[model samples]
Target: MTDNPLSQAEYDAVTDAAAHWCMRLHANDCTVEERLAFEQWHDAHPLHAFEYEYEYEAMLEIWDVAGDLPRPETVAPMVRAKPATPWRTFGIAAAVCAMALPLAAYSGWNLGWLPDSYQHFEANDNVRQVTLSDGSQVELNLGSELTFSNYKDQRRITLKKGEAFFSVSHDTRHPFIVKAAEGRIRVTGTKFNVWMYEDQVRVNLIEGSVLVSSNDAVAGDGLRLEPAMQASYRRGDFTPRISQTYDNDNSLAWRSGKLVLDDLALTDALPLINRYLSKPVMVADNSTGSIRIGGIYNIKELNNLVASLPKVLPVYLTRNKDGNPVLNSIPQQAPKS
Candidate 1:
């Protein structure tokens, strides 16, 4: 064992780093460069390797308690240490004591453990409001789904679909994170709205600040976003863009039962509009999808917007057999006889 005496803060940082390394090692596709980086990190400090080994042993102990499961064949064999009293062996006594009876069963040294229970919020036709365990409030927009899980050191939220506005409470010790689509948003205290439309992810900062990054935490320096700014990333794109002057209020208009589109393409705007109703508005083809539309219309006046489409552009609107709106381009009219 290493002989370094660590301060509480230093210990937490080392363990967090160890957790990240352990997670990387478990990945089946961990590459040569990653292994080399791990080696370099381990060699940088004696305590680094020691923390990793301790974490690995704790994981193995969990597997042993789970059943006599075999260890991952890739890792080098560790000399078995005699087990001590239950939690003391892993140095997780403080964490175990912090958990309630039910939560203690689910809490583990692994990085991915969720507490005993999480709050699941899903919205259909109407928007929903949720207050988390840490006093953070979320305005879940229509057709959205998310799960909120709290741990001793972090508040984690996974947005499965659609959009939500987050009002995060201040907790410097515990960061607030939202995982959506292909990236994540990390914050200490902030107000922001995140929208996931298919493979695209957009985060608009209303106040305070946040760090936005791709799912790969080690890949690149994450983007820092401040008030009145927006960051957008799409799948397969090399990099995301941060807009200094995006009209964020337009996106949040849904909270007031209004639909606001500001020169947005028909293809992009349709999905957001569709979220307000059960029956959707579909574009007939790619040609009609390129038309730019800008307006502020009440969601309750969807029929009026559909009726007025032909007046604004060369498009024909019709309903499918299921009573869903289908938009198509208007064919040329013949000369009058």
Candidate 2:
């Protein structure tokens, strides 16, 4: 309803609130209830209603900017940050233009590198199990961010951010490679997970070993992580530590909407909780943030998780200003020590 929008200031206010509501709605974890409430709230005032619709429409346009382009129906969501500029242009240009991305990138790739086409995957909010031209299966985890790049000889899977698991169907010709946070993971055939957030990068080998090195090969030295081994790499160095290992039980359960908090304290579980929901989660105090908790909870069912938390911690979950979630853990006063 830009026809008669709200005052500039009013429009900004409503639109900003609406954007936040969108995130809240997303984190609502399920159903259109939040969206419905938002609609009602937006329509409460003429100006607010108009601004809401205008912003909503803008969102649709930005999303459909790649109008009618063939894209994977569901993909692991990426952080709500800007996608590469180059990909956006390609999206608009390729829509319905008899577009055919190299299907080989989805099939059997051999000794050679991935083509430039794979560099830009149009993904969304679901795990993308991609078969490289070499027959390697690369499963991109939820919200895991990555890009594709094609070199003359080696196919590259660049974990721009987030995480992914590779269950490579071995091919001797082409060595499977994963790139993340200025580090490189290379393996011939095996299962492994690469998690990257900012400079925190880790590689967990599930089945086979991978030769990992800092992307800055000139200055960075990585190492081989054998099965059940994990390493944390930052600033181009791997903090030598045996990675956590799991068997028959669900590994990477997040992909299945399950959060396995293994004997994790409330404090320890905070990070995973924050990651699952779109909205932010924080502890009110550092002391509370350090509490450990353990148990498994379905990612979509937060109430169960919340109700169970109290039994496991000396804290309460409270809302902060601006509606962010904060944990407030209290303990019995110690007798005059």
Candidate 3:
């Protein structure tokens, strides 16, 4: 056996190869020929044998941690004595522990034992419905974006922007969580409408109860909404402002291809209205945006609303340099001189 030290790349390659062989030999479907091949490879080089022993010990430790092990009778015989090098053992242990975490995490993720990262979904200028793996249905409004992940203990969803209606399936063991802006809504099974404005989130519960809270982990530090109740909160708020009675139909009218506005500021209304339009409309100044408006307008017929804006409110529609419509407040008439 050569006493020369291995370069970093060479050592990594040998360790990786040894780990691969160790996993292959431990597999239930390992064949006689494969075992012979591993034996031959283990004896081919001193480094190979050393790395194999280290990886085998590492695999055993991993299996112990994972609570899965091959039968004692079926265990393969060790091909060589473990080296008594203290530094080498320490290095191997550290590397094995580091490797074990990611390996175990990947396996757990595949087996549905761990939470998955976000899987993004978006509806740009059109409404769409998505069914999750847990059989929950989400109806995304126009210009909306959402992300979701199903963990073993809980199913989580984040409303990144715009609005969505959730029809969650019943699963008492796994609580359903919806996060929007600074708030979190937790439920077991429920149908609800969640609207995410620029800096606020509105949740209107149609059926089932939901606990809306801030990011804090304090127990009972939130508001619980019964069916037909609505709650809203701005970013950074500790608790949502509850509305015991709300216009549920108006809140969900966007789902039926309509935009319902009731004394809502033009600033707030433009964002909802622009979701249906190919070209977005912008206000010239705050005065145009501050105008209070109310209407039930067909989303498909947005042009009608643009034409009627001047007649209903003190605003005029004009085109910007980019050809997008801009709403400007009409100048008040001067008194007779």
Model 3 global lDDT (CA atoms, 0 to 1): 0.75
All predictions: root-mean-square deviation over Cα? 15.6, 14.6, 15.1
lDDT of 3 by residue, 158-225 (tens): 78788999999999998998888877999989999998867778898999998998655545737899
TM-score of 2: 0.57
lDDT of 1 at 43: 90
For 11-47, candidate 1 gives per-residue lDDT tens digits of: 7898778756765676567799999999999998877
Give me candidate 1's TM-score against the actual structure.
0.61
lDDT of 2 by residue, 189-258 (tens): 8998887655667677888788877655554445778787777677555333445565744547756767
Kindly give the stretch of ten consecutive residues in candidate 2 with the minimal lDDT sum.
91-100
TM-score of each: 0.61, 0.57, 0.60
lDDT winner: 3
State each model's CA lDDT, in order. Answer: 0.73, 0.59, 0.75
Give model 2 RMSD, 1 decimal: 14.6
